[model samples]
Structures are given as structure tokens and as C-alpha cells.
Target: MSAPLAAVPALTAPKAPKKLRSETVALDSGLTVVAVRKPGVPLVEARLRVPFLSAKAAHPARANLLAEALPTGAGGYDRAGLAAAVQALGGDISVSVDADRLAVSGNVLATNLRALLDLVAALLVEPAYARPEVATERARLVERLGMARARPGVVASEALARRMWGAHPYSLDLPDGDAVAAVTQAQLHATHRDLVRPAGATLVLVGDLPTARLVEQAGAALADWTGSPAARRVPALPASPGGPLLVLDRPGSVQTSVRYGAPAVPRSDPGFPALQLANLIFGGYFSSRWTENIREDKGYTYGPHSRVDHHTLGSTLALDVEVATEVTAPALLETHYELGRIATLPVTEAEVESVRQYAIGTLALSTATQAGLASTLSALAAFDLGLDWIAGQPKRLLATTVDEVSAAAARFFAPTAFTSVVVGDAATIAAPLAALGPVER
Candidate 1:
């Protein structure tokens, strides 16, 4: 039998959500804490970000090594012992490292938040970079580095960073092989002491719990944690470290990987929302013009993407695409065409609304889960922002006009502003690329 039709309700624009109430506290030990009370769920999610600035350090890969070895054991617990303990608590924790920080994140029953937190304290305070463990991790890192060197994407990305940052530590993503081999247990220990300090670091927690309870427990658990301040100084970037095409020559390669980007505004900028929407309308999503032009029409690549990546010091708008070597030049030309069009032409209100809704929907979905909200809050804290900053995103994006999107596009998305690199068979694509513009060997 056919179901009876229900009352049809007319659609309307979504109203502003109730403000999210969150607390930010600077602990006496200098660790920052951002806590939001989400009461529906019974799980607690937490993240710890300790900035890793290895520019002046002896071994830039030491943090990377620590990320692997930390999980083996700490504070009188072996690998098996630690795993058993976490399992007993009905919780799990993991560690990872990036250009900026080492992230220690985990989830647990809301009632067991304090227990998991204590384990975290132990791991960070007395991380066991034991010799045997370090050697095993070093072997793994070496193997991974060798594999990354062979991958065209990694090769091109590393080359671009080296050209942009010069001798800055940031330029080196995978540590030099010799440097990785040279990292000693003592060095790892010292690096942790100097860089893993609570000062300027953040600890974010989100879940169903009283704000006061979570704050008090966190303060007590991390009370004894202390160390030297993390080094965080913005490096002096070149006036223009982009433009010339650097090719990562891979002989006999069947495809070329294209990377395009330049330094751009940070998230806190007033024009950020509009710029973000502009990126979306251009290539940040599947429905973007860049994707439609290159993937749907021209059949140049499987997917093309662009994003604004942020760090402690600066931000960048990066675009990436991979196409067959035969079509590399044509693909590059079309990409430029799309960039020029976006920068020069005004976007329609319909396009603006589509991107705005997508942006808002994404933000809402990101904070819909306890773990998601925790990580989101943690990333925001790195920029000295809180929930309020994210709470108003829908409004900011909604208020943005098509003209504003066009202005942002012109200012930041101009094709000429980009410095690009292509990784593929230079012998095949070099001539075509040179015809388009200057090509550096």
C-alpha cells in the first residue's frame, strides 16, 4: 500500500545556531586548555599539540622518531603493558607528527577521562626513547624515506618546499637520510626536553562532562608538567619565492604531477571567509570550476584540488593535479585559463550561495562528533582562536557577496601570483612548458 503523504513544510534559510559555550584557560604551567561541554555523548575526546620547531635543532627528524617510539612504552610501561592498560580503561591513544607539532590524541569513556589523561601525562613526561625502540623506529623511518623519494608527489613537494624555504628547517619534510641515521637516543631525549614543553602548547578536550570537572582534572593531571618554551618565530620569507617552474625530472615517467601555490592570508584575516569560498568555487570541492574544466571536460586528471594550509607562522594556498605526460602542457594551460577567469570575472550569486552552503555544511559536520570537535578546537587554539571564531563562520560566509568573492579571487587567486613545479619526464614536457614561460633547470 502507498504511504499517505505527510504535511509539506516550506523550506527556509537556516537560522543562526545558539552560541557554543566554551572555556579557555591558561594553566599555571603555561599549557593552554580549551574545553567545550557537549553533553549528549558519553565519550571524551582530547588532543595535545606540542609545537616542534627543529630549525635550530641538530636533527630535524628526531620528533618524527619520537612519534613512532613514544607508543612503545613510557613511565614504567612496555608496549604490551601500555596497550593493555589503555584497553582496560576502554580507551585508545595515538601519536603523529607534522611540520608544526606532535599530536597526541585519544578517546575514552567520559568517566575515564582522568585515567586516560594520567596515562598521557606519563607518556609525555617520561617518553621512553629507549635505544632498541629507537633503532627499530629509525629503520622504519629509513625505509619510508626511501619509498617517499621514489614517489613523484613527495619528490615534487619536497623540491618546492626546499626552493621556497631555502635552508630553513621547514623546507625539509622527510629528514635527510644521514640526518635520520645520526639521531641518537640522547638527542631525542634532549629534543623532547626543549621542544615538548607545555608553554605555548595546547590541550583540548571535548565531550559530555561538566566544564569545571574537566578543567580541575586536567589542571591536576598536568600540574607537574613543565619544560622550556617551544621555539616559535616566523621566518623571513622571500619577497617572492614563487614563479619559475622547477621540474623534478623522473625519466620515462608516464605522468606529471603539478603543484601550484603561493603564500596567502591566514584564517584570522577578515577576508578569509570570502577567500575560502572563492577557493571552493574555484577548486576546493568536486563541483568547482577547476574540477569541471579539467576533469569533466578536458579529461586531464582524476581529481584536482586546492586548499589553504596554515602553520604557526604563515599560510599558503596550494593546488595540485596529476596528468598524463602527453597532456601535461595542455592541462597546465587550462588551469591557468581557469585561474585567470576566476580572478578577472565576477562570480554569480548562485555560485557564491552554493559554495557558502557547502562551507557551512562542512563546518557543521566537522563539529558534529566529540572527536571531531576536539580536533577542530585544538587546531583553532593553535591560531589563538576559540569556538566563537568557528561559530560565526556560517554568518560570515552568508554575509559575503559575490563581489566580495570576486575581489578575494583577484587579490589571492591571480594566476600570475602562483609559483609552480611540475614533476614528470622533463624530456617530454620541457619544451612545451618553456614555450609557455621560463623554465628553470
Candidate 2:
């Protein structure tokens, strides 16, 4: 009863174009300011990055405590007063402490940028380091550390870091419950004086405001900020003590969490970009080998992937996935097989194009807002990269060849050096996984 219909061509949507440009200004005080000017936006985001944090300090948690404590009360304002002032001015301030850096950042309306900058400078240079606030925050951190220990994923990650880096400070677990309880206000103050030095730190400002004006304001705001001469040094990460499997037993787990990876290139490694692209093809995306093999084809887990954890001193290629307990071993095997495939087989031209498109397309999304642009610029400055680095990303990603990707995969993904971490019933899976490599209890 139906007439034959002619086949219609499929309509394809045009790819979205990329738009965004950034500029960087180097301040006289060794501070680097980066900014992006966008049309029709009247907001500015400024972030100040101090290079030393938990990893570089004599007492790491002290830096952690100070970051939280600084914003509570500074200059002549009490904790409540500071909060009210920021709220009334329609601005927000936050402090973040990570392994390699501590950042005090804020967002403000373009009209109120100067006041916000003044407030941030006071927090940094004129903090009273109120002992009462320090005691309160330290108590909260101790409680948080206790909660983290009960988390399976947290336990697995911290264990992996410890195993991978041994005694390196980077591997130091964030203060445990007992360690946090032992930290004192005096120690926090001493740690602040030692690591948060101007010579080793950099101030990064990113926003749409005039660069010259911001630099001038920063100079006046932070003029008296000085620190005792000291250089922070991190112990070298030992070569991955590659061996067998290590598993942490989370007895009641219905789903097994797995992390398998090995040491890879650092941020400064010349092969960083190539390795980054190569990883994108392997497991860095939703359509990558690990996803297709471990999830789609085998149905072992929801999804699986890998990332290059680019640290200041070193980096790692980490693959993580969650699967049913019964399928954990097979899923890990599939992960390793996928890793080897990129090196052993020639990658298809189609796959290369697909990944290149994905990488560049996603990057454009990352710079969509003023805050986003500022964050990107801050990262570039932290890595000592130039403004052109952003513009060159698309070209570099597209120019990678199959041969180059294969070589990069081979150089970075070594199955022998691959360390496996399974957070589930070690009693149930340990014997089977041990056959793959030596089993570390």
C-alpha cells in the first residue's frame, strides 16, 4: 500500500567555530597577569597563585589550614564582617589549597574590581592569622580527614600515590585524623612564614579590566609583601616500582573500583603535547579504546578511561573504571589490552581525525566565559607558557600522525610498568589477579 520513496541525504550540522584571544602582562614584582577581553561582558575574575602549598612545606597541613583561615578574618575585619563586606559588594572570594599551589581567588563586578583587588591583597599581605579561627578550622579539617578514610575511592587513590611515590612528600596523605589532631596554631603560623614566599610564588590576574591599571594597583596593594629567603624543593619521585597487583579490600563493595597506570611525562616534557593527543585516542575520551572495549563491546563497566595527571615535577598515565565485582579481573585485562593496542596496531585515519576534532572542540568550550578564560590563562602562566600556546593547540592536535601516535603510545604505555589497584574484596580477587603480576597485600 506504500509507494517507494526516494532516499534522502542526511543533513549534517556545521562545526562550531572557536573564538577567544588572551593577553599576558609580566609585573615588575615577578608576578604574571593574564587577561582576555570579550565583547559585551562587564565582569572580571582575578586569581593569585602561590607556588608552594601542601607539598612544599615542612608541615603540609599548615598551608591547608592557613588557606581556609585567611579569608575568615583579615585587615581590621572579623570573620562575619569580611563575609558581609564581600556580599554587600556583590563579589565572592575563595581559597583553594592543592598539592603544588595555593590560590586565593575572587570574582567581582567590573565596577567593583578595585575594591575586590584591595580586599584580596589585604588577605594575602595583612592577615592577622587569628589563633581562634585557626583552631576552629583545624578541628574541621581533622573531621574531614576522618571521613575521607572511610571512602573506598579515596583509600584506593591515596594508596596508589603512596605505592607509586614511596616517601616523596607528594605521596604524603593529607593529614590523617591523628595527624590533623596533632597540628597546632603555632605550627601553622611557622609553616606560613616558610613556604608562602614572594620569590618562589607568582600572582596571576585574569579578567577584562585594563592590564596596566591592574598591574599598578597590584604593586600598591602588595608593596609591603615580603618573605624570608627560602627555596622550596620536592624530593624526586622514584621510578615506578613496577611489579604485580595491589588491592585494597573494601569488604562490602558491590562494585569494584580499579586504577591502573604508570609514570609518564611531566608538564615540561617535550613530548607532552604528543603524549596528550596519543592519550586522547587511547582512553582520554568517551569514544576511546577503553570505553569501546571495556564498556560497549564487553559490557564490563559503565565506562572506562585514562588521563595524564600532569604534576609540576612528574606525571602519570592513570586508567580508572568501576565494574561489577565478578567482572573486575576481565575488565582490567581489557584495559591493559586496549593500552597495548594503540602501540601495536596502526591507528586509523578516521580515529585520528575524530580525536583531533574532539580535543580542539572541547578546548574551545573551556574558554567560553570570562572566568574560564582567566583560569586557562592562569594555568598557562603557571606552566610558563606564552599566549600563543592557546592559538597553537588546534593546529598541533590536528597535525599528529598515526605513526607518531603509535610511537607515543609505545613510549608512554608500558604494560610491565603498569600498576594495578583494585578497591574491592581483596580476599576474593587477589589470588586471580596475582597471576597477572606479583600480588602486594
Candidate 3:
């Protein structure tokens, strides 16, 4: 009834990354600027990273509000006027904050690169956290945080963060809504003054301009944006003391959200390439073993994924999945089984080859565009890594062997290494899940 399947073609090894034309410069005000010349489109992309980590109890709420309002008004322009100015110069800019850093990112026509940098300098030197704008953004932030906290996935993630990091700033990924409501415009102004500065910050520029010229434009425009931020580096992430699973009761929930977290190596680590491939083969890709077992064979969840997330302070291997509430226990059992299997067993040569190609290919694809390269460079700058590190990744992946990947898997992917959280109807799933291991209610 059906024709025989055609033989799949063998995959070709990815070509080596071409050498990049780039330069790094330290400006007078203690800012680090990385400029790369990537020609294709007539656009330039810019990213600025300011170290924004803080352990103070009220810092998260203040930082969130500051990110929201920083670009809304700056220099002499109101929100609308600033938008108009950027549009006139064929550019756009936005600001975002996280536990590690405050980042400003945007793109502009290559011809307007200097103009966009000037606008960025305006935001840095003279952000107008005006009363009206702060009030508006604050109200909106509270509403968004409320909605996010209400979602099962967000709840599970927040719970996992707390369980893994304890009282660390990393535990406070989302600020409390009441804290946000209490923030004042003066507080946001103070936050900007205290944290948003040039020292220990990096600006990445990628576009059609010559690398040297891009650095010159950035330096010239940002000369007035001076001063070092206070010493606010986030402390080292605490080791995840993997213990009992946290089970939070969400009445009448039809689906269970399962989240797991464990500490992992940074990209600069020697074992990172091996761990990266092992992670992908385990659950990080569509055709991964966990996906095949849980989603394809058992139909427990639509998709189960694992990834290694890099932050300025540390890296974490995270697992996330959602399954029917009734199947929560079985889904978790299957997850644990997959983790144990990968950790204890030797990965096949074929498996290593497949994920190696995949890892190298994805790295190439992620940095192929002007905007993508700019963002990648900005993220890497946190660890003082640069284009050379990126260009050498393929060689690392290719050289990684089955034994090395298996070793990384055994070290990092042990089921007992993870601290997990499950959010669903506790009455229905608790006893079954406890049958597997200890669960804290």
C-alpha cells in the first residue's frame, strides 16, 4: 500500500566559520565597545549591556520600572517625541532588565548609525523618568506581573527559581506586584543614577560600516555618558541542593507543569561543548530521546524540552514540560528514566555525530545576521568571550567524542542533580508522585 522510504542523505560537515573583521576598544569613560563589519543589508545593530545585578530587597521592582521608562522619554523628548526622532532616523530602540544586566538594543539604517548612537547617549546621560511616564509604566508593569504570576508555567518557574536559589537575587525573577505598586518616580531616578553607567558595561555594534568607524562613532556620541556603576555584581549562584520535589496545589488545573533546574557549566568551560551536545541529544531538540519517549511513544506531553541557559553569574540546565494532570506521575517517571539512561549509558557514535553537527549548525545560524551577531556578541561579552571564541566552537564540537558527551551527561544530567517543581491539582497527583519520591507540599 505504501512505497518504501527513501534513504536519508548523509549530512555534510559544516564549513569553518569565516574570519570576522572586528575591533574592541576601551573608551575614555571606561566603556568597552566591540564593533564588527558585517555587510549585506544597509542596517546597523547596537546592543548595550550594563551590569544591573543587586541583592537589595527592593531592587527588582525598581529595576523593572526603570527599564520600562528609560526609553519612553530621554534628553528633552517626551515618549512620543523620542519615538518620532528615532523613526525619522530609520531606527528603533528598547530597554530590558533581568537578574544579571540591563540591556538596551536596537537597529538603524547604516547611514543613520551616528544619529542612533547619539539617541542612545541621550538615554544614558539624561533619561527622563518623568512623573507621568513612570506612573503609566508602573501601572502597566503591575498588571503584566499579575497576569504572569497567574499562569501555571510562570508559577512553576518562579517556584523552581526559589527552590533552587533560596534567598539569592536569582530567585526573584519577577518582582512582587505590591512592591512594583509602591515604587515612586524618585526611586526610579535614583536607580538609574546608581546603576546605569559606562564602566563594566559593553556596547556591541554590527553593520555595514567599517569596524574602526563604528567604534569612532560610538565613542564620539557616548563621550558625555561617563561614570562607573556601583559595585553591584550578583553573587555567585548557590549550588542547587537537589532535594524533594515541590508540589504546589492549583485547584482544577487540567495540565501539570513540570520544571527542573540544575547548575551547569558556562560556555567558556572546557566541558561545555560536550555538555551542549549531550543536552541536545537528551532533550534539547525535537528528535531527542526524551521527546521521542514521552511525546511520540507515550503521548504524555506535547513537547518536553531541556536547555542550558547562560547567565552572567552562572549557567543552568533546565527542563520544562506540560502533561495532562492525570499523567503527571508517569510523565515524571519517564523523565527520570530518560535522564538516568543517558547518564549511565555510553552514547553511540552515530548519536554524537548527529548532535555535533546540530550544535555546530545552530551556532552558525544564530550568528549569521547583523542583528543576531550583535546580540550574540553582547551576551558573550559578559564572560569576556568574543569572536574568536565563537569561531572556534565548531572545532570543539567536532572534536568532542562519544565518551566525552557521555561523561558530561553522567555528570550533569543525573536525575538526582535536579531540583524540580510541579504545579497542578495536588489532590489527584500527590499520592502517585510521592510513590516515586519525596514531594513537599
Q: Which candidate ranks first by TM-score, i.e. highest? A: 3
State the C-alpha lDDT per candidate: 0.85, 0.73, 0.93
Clashing pairs in 3: none
List of clashing residue pairs for candidate 2: 244-438
Task: Work out the TM-score per prediction.
Answer: 0.95, 0.91, 0.98
Off by over 4 Å in 2: 1-28, 53-58, 267-270
lDDT of 2 by residue, 229-286 (tens): 3555567778877666788888768878887768888544556667887888888998
The whole-model C-alpha lDDT of candidate 3 against the native structure comes to 0.93
lDDT of 1 by residue, 120-152 (tens): 998889788878988998999878888888889
Which stretches in model 3 have alpha-carbon errors above 4 Å? Answer: 1-6
RMSD of each: 2.8, 3.0, 1.4
Model 3 lDDT per residue over 276-390, tens place: 9999999999999999999999999999999999987789999999999999999999999999999999999988898888888888999999999999999999999999999
Clashes of each: 1, 1, 0
What is the lDDT, from 0 to 100, of the residue 80 in candidate 1? Answer: 86
How does candidate 1 fare on TM-score?
A: 0.95
